[model samples]
Target chain A: MSARRGKLWSRTVFLLILVTVAGVVLLPILYFLTISFASNYEAYQFPAKILPTFSYPARLRYNADTENYTLLLKKGADFEAVKTTSDASDFSLYCKSQLNVLISPPAVQTLFDRAKASDQAVPIKLRKDFFRNYVVFFILAEGTMRALFNSLKAAGWTILISLVLGGVTGYILARYKFRFSTTFSTSLLVVRMFPAVALSLPLVVYIMRMNLYDTPFALAIVYSVPNIALTAWITSSIFKGISVELEEAAMVFGATRLKTLRTITLPLAFPAIVASSLYAFLAAWNDSITALIMTNDNPTLALLVYRTVGSSTIPNLPAAGAVVLLIPSLVFTFIIKNYINQLWGKVAL
Target chain B: MSYLKLSSLKKTYPNGVTAVKDIDLEIEKGEFVVLLGPSGCGKTTTLRMLAGLEEVTEGSIVLDGKDITHLPPRQRDISMIFQSYAVWPHMTVAENIAYPLKLRKMDKRAIASKVEEVAKICKIVDYLDRYPAQLSGGQRQRVAVARALAVNSKLSLMDEPLSNLDAKLRVSVRTFLKEIHRNTGATTIFVTHDQAEAMALADRIVVMNEGRVEQVGSTREIYNECGSLFTAQFMGTPPANIQKVALASSRGRLVAAAGGGEGAMPLDLGDRSAFPGMEGLIGNEVFLAVRPENIAIGEPDGVNEASIEIVEPQGAYTILVTRVLGGEWKIMLEGDVDFRIGQKVSLKIDPGKVMFYDAQSTKRISLS
Candidate 1:
């Protein structure tokens, strides 16, 4: 009975810890998603909403003594007079900028005349266009689609370059026992230790001399510098776990060394290769400073999103951009998760 | 010309350690030859050199009239089963067998048929579609065998293929491999450290020690007529009982005396005429080796009297342990012969079966 109770106590503690960790990770993303869907007015709401709001109950009233129109917004059960405007255009502008509720000046003037003639408060019913922030971000932002394409191209090239060069280096390091192999392997880590920013300045000059400046390929070249070393480090250990006799068996069975690598070694090391590609992709996809120095007219989406955050005080536009930036990374990670699981020995290939 | 010939095969690593030193062997076609040795005896190195997996440092290998000393493994028509049973984990059993055929540019239909044929022979046909990781170690070993057999190469090499299996599985696989060899009739060179596996499988066994071949012969010759002290000591379970003794003639018979003093009692070894040309060296010290089964236990009379120290019943045969010539010696008696500990017994050394070697050189001495 004591053992059972102890087991139950441990399970309860484990569950509490699991929930805390999940909330810590997921709650911020949920709040960010709500902000991405929020309007300019909703962005400034106090105590900020964790869930998106679509519509608000409001009332427009004409004050007789002040000779102005008052906008009353619903706050819980009661109405709060948030703003007052004297003229029709002023009221229209206020609603458009602060409330993010579109109202033409002529329509506002008619409503104001009706409110003044009748001594009663007029009810104003408004529904929010929830996807308006996302639509406006894409429409107003310059070269957003082009930046998205450039980010993809850069990440694609990074994966290609790193996997090809690093995979061959990994195979050689795992198989051969030449002189200074340990020294060579340790030096690859030293190369990774140097920050990519330190290399970007000198690399830009060479990139320009080759007439490849401001291109996604130039950015990929910078991204692949640190990524190749990282990829080689990861893949070499995994390749070591693979048996060398498997390759020798292939060779002894009348397959050439190249053919053996293609049919045997590469397939056996595929999960690690896929995992390395994910690292290479994220490095190129999420980098801003390296792309900042390496590109000019052709900035990647991450750099574009970073620039958007600086230009806007209201975060809705930039939040929308960040969500858009997150989709591809999420998709790639989801696809590569199975391969990573295989690397951890969860599934046999 | 021999089907496969290795002339002066020597392997010296880059660090200047020699694994195989000047090995010369010739194997005829359709013969199953086993290289038997302890670990680091260079048997695997010799097999690897023949398979073109290792570089031939100061040697030449000629296989079926082709000088394939430096050719890569693919260019040489040979198939090898690794000790780890390296059936490709990424491939299904059928794909593993078909891959070599595909590399040879055989048609897809022919490759499929050949895979089916070998899979049936190896009894892995039911698991043709299953990956190697899904199969047990023994089944994966059969997949490796099927893959090697699928190519129908000029030669087949197995490097301790059955070493990874359980003991019972090892014996069954040994018989299965021998049966496969008989059916296929491919010239095979198998490397193993197990003497029983070698004896059970090989048409001729090449016993190796250190980096050189100690002796090569049929099982009976290697067992009863070992050419060197190393072969005699290395070839048997419980091994041969060896002692350093001086031969002396006593009572019109030849005897081997063990210690130097008054306490020394000579073990009787039959007539002097049996050991021709050994009469001149009667007083010279020589090494005497006797198999456990060769020495007979009888009623104590006075010659080579010793007390039985232990008795071990092994289901079919009983091993009786006693002291002979001041060294612990084992005697194999058939079928549970009851013997008590500390009981006095007489040990009769078989004169014809007793082997002698020069103490300095450790080489066998001819008696007749």
Candidate 2:
């Protein structure tokens, strides 16, 4: 009985430790989601309850003659309120702007009759204004989507440019020896280690002078430089691991030099090519500083996230936009996660 | 006419290592020539140079009548099997065999028929669709041979192809190779470091050492009439034991040493007129080369006293290590000699079979 009890206690301790770790990691994300759904009145409440346990409807009292407590609203109307309700100011005014709200005939009649028949004016409730923040957020998120599409386009072209150029360079660097082969390989790594941000200032001025700013083509060209170095170094190491004797055997069997490379060498190095492309894609996708400095009118998704931090007003629209930005890269990684082992030639984790 | 001839072929690397130095070899229409030597003896390098796999530093490689020294391996019209087999790991047995045919753009029917024919010839018909990794070592070696045969070249260059096999497998494969050569009449240049393999399979064995040919002849010729002292010592299993013995010369006629008594057998060292410098060489030492099989145990009449140091009784013959001529010499005697260690035994050397060499130069002297 004591051993069984001790086992249960250990399992409980393990679960507690796991939960503590998860809570620490997920607390900020949980806070942001709660803030997105909380009402302004509830947000300003003392000892604020961020999570709603029960449905709390807005309540308003009528004049002394009528005992009905109801929500006062008008169709195609505007109203102001002056009252003391919760700890915060109760005189919150609501104005219906240029937003369409669908209402039932009976509920519209009830709101209209209450505002017209009462001597003391009833407060008007605006349903559209409560959701107006999301409307602005939707437009900004659409812009973010366009920016993200542009970034993917740039990264895609960068991968194409880097792979073709880097793959051939990588194969030669790995297989052949010349006078400066080691020096050439190390120089590529030096290019890769150079800070992209350090060059962005001069790059931006050059792009502006060349009239190539605010274009996906300009971003792709800029992104290809760093990705080429990275792809070449990475793919070259992987290509070096493959045996050269296989290619020689193919040639001995009457295959031409090109045919031998096509049939034997390329297939063996394909995984390295794909892995290099993935590294190229991620490098272009996550890069923000260069894109921020290079273009003003057309921004990448990463640049858009950086633009969301205003001085006095934290733009919730871009905060929500940042959340959408994480989805595509996450989906891409998850889809190709199985091939990662083959790509790297080993199990990564 | 020879099917393939390499006249004065040479290979020197850029690092100043001369791998092959003026090698000349000719393979007749169906003759099997083996380049036999120890490692780094330029035998493999010579074979590679013939196959057009190694660049020749000098000389011409002629196949049939055309010079092919500068031709690439694919255009050389020859097949080579490496020591590692070099079989395509990703391809099946049939695909590997049909590779050379496919490169020529042969029709599907022809490819299938040729692959089937070669597979049957190699006795791997059932394993036509299996990859090399799935086959046994011996089977893979046979597939490598079949792949080479599928090319249908005039010559086959094999570089220690059976070295990877076990002893029994190596023997069986060596027999298989010899039988195939007999049937196909393809001029084969085989390279091996194993002396026994070369002796069993080669029509003419070219013994090489340090990028130079030591001797090149039939196994019987190399064994019976080894010209150099190196060849005599390198050929046999228990190599020829050399010793220094002095003989007496009087009036230009040579006889046994003075220590031998009146009943001692006289050694006829023919024609002292040819050996003009023997007048002052009465006490001079002369080298005697005797094969271990020529020595025998006998009575004291024709025997010399020697103490047996060790006796190893093999199944059919026993090898006795005895102190003879002031040093230990391994003596091969037929049957179990039941001789114990430290036993004083009488040893007889057949004077007619004994070889004499100039003591200073280590060259064979006239003994007829």
**Listed models, DockQ each:** 0.58, 0.19
- Regions of candidate 1 where Cα sits further than 4 Å from its true position: A62-69, A83-96, A100-125, A343-349, B259-264
Which portions of model 2 miss their true places by more than 4 Å? Answer: A1-138, A141-149, A160-188, A199-239, A295-299, A305-349, B242-304, B310-328, B332-339, B347-368
lDDT string, candidate 1, B184-260, tens digits:
99999999999999999999999998889999999999999989999989988878988888989987788888845
Q: For residues B1-368, write the lDDT of model 2, one tens digit per residue.
A: 56787788888988899998887777777788999888998998998877766789999888998888998778877787878887766577888888888897889999999889888889999999887777889998999989888888877889899999999999999999998888887888999988889999989989887887878899987676666666666777687877666767656555544232334344334346645555665666776667889787765443366678988999799999976645568899998768878877677665555666667876666534
The fraction of reference interface contacts (C-alpha pairs within 8 A across chains A and B) present in each candidate is 0.75, 0.29
Candidate 2, position B331, lDDT: 93
On DockQ, the leading prediction is 1
Docking outcome class, model 2: incorrect
Clashing pairs in 2: none
| Clash count in backbone of candidate 2 | 0
The C-alpha local distance difference test score for the whole of candidate 1 amounts to: 0.89
